[model samples]
Target: MGGSGAGGTNTGKRPNGQLGSWFLRSGWSKGELARQVNRRARQMGAHHISTDTSRVRRWLDGEQPREPIPRILSELFSERLGAVVAVEELGLRSAHQSPSVSGVDLPWAGPQTVALISEFSRSDLMLARRGFLGTSLALAAGPALVEPMQRWLVPTSAGGQEQPEDEPVATPSRASRLSGPELDLLESTTAMFRLWDAQCGGGLRRKAVVGQLHEVTDLLQEPQPEATSRRLFRCAAELAELAGWMSYDVGLQPNAQKYFVLALHAAKEAGDKPLGSYILSSMSRQMIHLGRPDDALELIHLAQYGSRDCATPRTQAMLYAMEARAYANMGQPSKTKRAVRMAEDTFSDAGVDGEVEPDWIRFFSEAELNGENAHSYRDLAYVAGRSPAYASLAEPVMRRAVDLFAEDTDHQRSYALNLIGLATVHLLKREPEQSTALAEKALKVAESVRSERVNTRLRKTLDTAARDFGDVAGVVDLTERLTAQLPESAEAV
Candidate 1:
């Protein structure tokens, strides 16, 4: 693969200037160059690249390499040469980068263009494993929102039809009004995800659900009528929102934010303000989880303001309660209490109608208030250094969230944190055994959820208990497990 024989093809010109400059300046042997390349490749996390003398000679003599190998070679040489080396300089520009979900040609693309989707997906997977919340936020809903809304407002097709793949095979239940192919597809997908969420956890199922939602989005894009099409689109949006929420739960904040925005677009087209509100609320919750309490507060306000007329009293109550949590986190106790009162007022108003809440919103009952307060107080406790009242509220509130969202890894993790909070209280009160037992119980639930935050907090509590209560074996063991999972930079390790 060398450029030519010793006497041929501009041999006296000493290869391309870029190649010649490197060789002459370094006065390196072919074999020595090969070794350098191999070392560089290893440092770059690359495996194969023959890196033999012959290959190095060919590369120096202006021979192009193949595909990814060429890119790696260029990168290696650039590092060694102390300059940027283009693929063309190595005569390997033709071997293009592989096409991902992004940087692709597609007719119908949403706000998460291919580039955004691919980056978001990889980011999600990485964040899930590392148990770190990604700090990316959603793009503003400007042109992205307007274009989709305008398109949906215009008539594209005469009638809506369901995909044959989505057809219902089983008889519909009396209580389950969901029928036909689209509804069947929706129910099945929801059930499948629900089960995965229980068994493997949301972190495991998030990608699959996101992919499915994208497929559903494509299917719903076909031209259809106003009413039926809108309903189908709304359902797809709901699924997308769920996928986003679960993704957020698993620490894929950037992707979750984009998906939520996409869900908002779909919901807007469907004229489903309530669903849009729910999506907004989900986004707000994610913001809070990421420790951006101010951003979360803004989102909650948006949700409450946008769905004032469309949302049911139950939904309103849920929104108010969420805002209360945000307010509490900000340490604005009066504002938090006001928000809680509003939620209570909404709930009381809804009680008169006795209207059933949506299945998705079923977890938002007054009985779940304890869990909400627990979460708020937990955040407050973290910010305030230490607060007895916050600790007191967190324990019972977390206990209730545990009971309600039990089997839910996310909630169970929250419950575990609450237990730790309670344990901290016990420790402050000089109760060693109670603290150790509570810490153990919290860790047990924590074992179920794939949460770095939960593990980190657990370690903090365990370490404190272990130091203060050195005789406690259980606390020591829990501390060890927590330490094992954390990076050395994290506390307790």
Candidate 2:
């Protein structure tokens, strides 16, 4: 595959003094150079690339690499040297250089969600913003999440999920009504989309989910009888939440926040307290991702309080576990342990009394709960100033999560993430080789999944390795794979 610029013919190898000079200046080994180039290309949406040390050696010997490779190389050099290193600066002709890589505000409006829903749906359906993307999206804080959570809590308030019984309900006669079959189709389709999302992560089929969300939101614009409204809004809530999740997986934190608000609003309209709480839990997860454990804790508390009366055992387990994660990240061992026990107890009682759970909430199975709690322990081990007690405790729990993920084949994203968690546990165990091995396994699974969050986490683990293991060979090799990734992922939300 090594050749001249895209569609250009390869000439005989001539010594590339220009590339060699920069190579010396940059100080990376050839293998390291190839790995970094491959990583940068993947970020640029070229995952099929396989640039090896041999490829880099050839490039230095003057076999001009393919179009994007030379451009990618130039960018890497620029960043490394802190200057605008052009393609030609790397001794490659820029005649056919690849081009450089380059928000919808649908607010809740009007008396009810009709105008808001209609506007969001139409705009989203018509929206097509797919281009080469490299985002620095901050997960929203303050009013972004707080206002939505408040609205969810007070269902009797304006634009609240449920219409107050004391008020006259408007069931518009001219509204386009959904038939039972149509409603069922939407429900089934949403479920199908969710299954695909579970297996593939947030990057794949994201547009399809947004499309489904649009349809549901559009239907929500038409006024309907109370029963009809409940069903329609429930579908909208589920779809919107799924869309938010997909966006979150792809690292579009701000966009994910908007979708989460839409889901919360839809749940408020349906008066589906449990579902609304679920959405809050998701927001809380986002907070944790953003390193705002305090915010994460607050969000979970709100969700728990709002759903206290009616949450199914599984739902309670999920929320409690989410709370545990927040506490773990905060280095609050006692509180984290307390919350974990609650999660375990609630999870044990999930189906004991024949309580029916929403199909969506049913996903919080033993494996999922195990994975969540494992993450909590892992965080306590590392995030809590490297507490050895928790570090010792994390390995076994994390291993169990990995085993469970292996048993559950359908949850590919979860499986991949749990593998990462286990690898982290190995990292904490001071077993650098073991950690590298486990991380390699995790990364392989991550390749089939399109979630940028997974890739980000992989980078984080490697960064940790670089800090902790110093000159360890395996750690060095793993670290070089993405050393140039994500300075902007740290931008404040």
Candidate 3:
């Protein structure tokens, strides 16, 4: 609730209650005004702004915004009122905008989104604090997710759009114009980064990935032909998606979500429906991990709806597999099975020859599908109270994934993850010896990678094994070995 005082009550106030008068005339509560300001700040890339009604109340009580916020509030009001609203008119003292600060507000236009990504990438790469990279912040972003989803689903026309007058525009460098060679370089760089992420995990090369994203951002400012620009946007989109995944790998969920949204916007600007769908799918995967299965389901369905007409069989298979995972998490066994079946059928229909899958989705091989199914079954088993039958069903697929992933160095993390899953299955079967052995092996492989996900999985495996078979000699030995070798943070139950 917001306090409302009539204009006549403070006609000759010293603080000049113009802001409050405007607030009352607009019929917006203090909380709503704070939300609007915070949102606008995000759009302007102010990463640390966390305003609430209390802050708004202070502003009404003659407390002024620190910096850049006054400018932001003026712009927000200007757009809403369809007239010029200067900083002085907002009854706030003007201050210099902060340098090197980036926020994660969703931009409506494609160009603005690109600029936002460019600035954020550069800031993320160089800034020490990286305050917006917190996993907890990302997990709590359900409300923030709605606006972007709506914008993607029902795009606004160019005519209805208004650019913030205070936004800093970058001048294009003549020497930085796009070329075929530059495009090739960007594409190759993206591929290299993807391989690095897959092989070594995101934490090991996250800074490098962010640096590369900054480079791409630099390229994005240059002028180019329409066709070349579109291709460049697609390439940049892929790189941004990889950067997002790398951020996720390092447990920087908020940063990951920002990059993912940037990638989505880039994909849309490029008119690459397949890439956009993949970006959405990636977002859904993150949501699923963050314990928002219903939100994850909506994003996955939106991807399917947008890409259904032109998505390749392999892409469709991947989307269905993701849906199955979401449903499994939601404890909807029937829907989970149905999505899994759809994925299987779609993959089966993907013939061996003359089928050109996008490079980004080429990872969805038979082994990947098997791994996805194994994960779904594992989730279902958990939902079923760790039933031995479901565990048994998961084991063979996990074994297959282990062997398949082992064949590719880029999939070492996946192989290790599958080993953890297999060990869990063994634990469910009360095979302490086998479980300890598999978990030990997984831990060894995980040690060579820098994935937080693999670390978390290994910790869970050891915890489960120790809880069930602490007295067993094999379990004791493995537990001691893990406690000595693993990080102190991960050694905790």
Best-to-worst ranking by TM-score: 3, 2, 1
lDDT by residue for model 2 over 1-493, one digit each (tens)?
Answer: 5322222334746778988999999999998998887766555555557787777877787776655676677656754663445566677864431211002223333234545544554444444342322221223454544654664554363443455544534455554467889888888898888888888887778778877777666666566666677788888888888888887787555557667777777776677889999999998898787667887888899999988998988999999999999999888899999999999998898899997777788678788898898889889987777666786777777788888888887788888888888878877778889888888787778777777777777887888888989799888876765555334232111
Which residue pairs clash in candidate 2?
Answer: 161-268, 161-269
Alpha-carbon TM-score of each model against the true structure: 0.60, 0.73, 0.74
Q: What are the Cα lDDT values of the candidates? A: 0.57, 0.72, 0.72
**Model 3 — which ten-residue stretch has the worst lDDT?**
2-11
Clashing pairs in 3: 42-105, 45-102, 45-103, 46-103
lDDT of 1 by residue, 330-363 (tens): 7887787788778778877765777765555654
Superposed by TM-score, candidate 2 places the C-alpha of residue 94 at a distance from the truth, in angstroms, of 34
Which should have the higher TM-score, number 1 or number 3? Answer: 3
TM-score of model 2 (CA atoms): 0.73
Off by over 4 Å in 2: 1-114, 121-127, 130-139, 157-169, 173-176, 477-493
The alpha-carbon deviation from the true structure for residue 101 of candidate 2, after best TM-score superposition, in angstroms, is 25
TM-score, structure 1 vs. true: 0.60
By TM-score, the better pick of 1 and 2 is 2
Residue 39 of model 3 has an lDDT of: 62
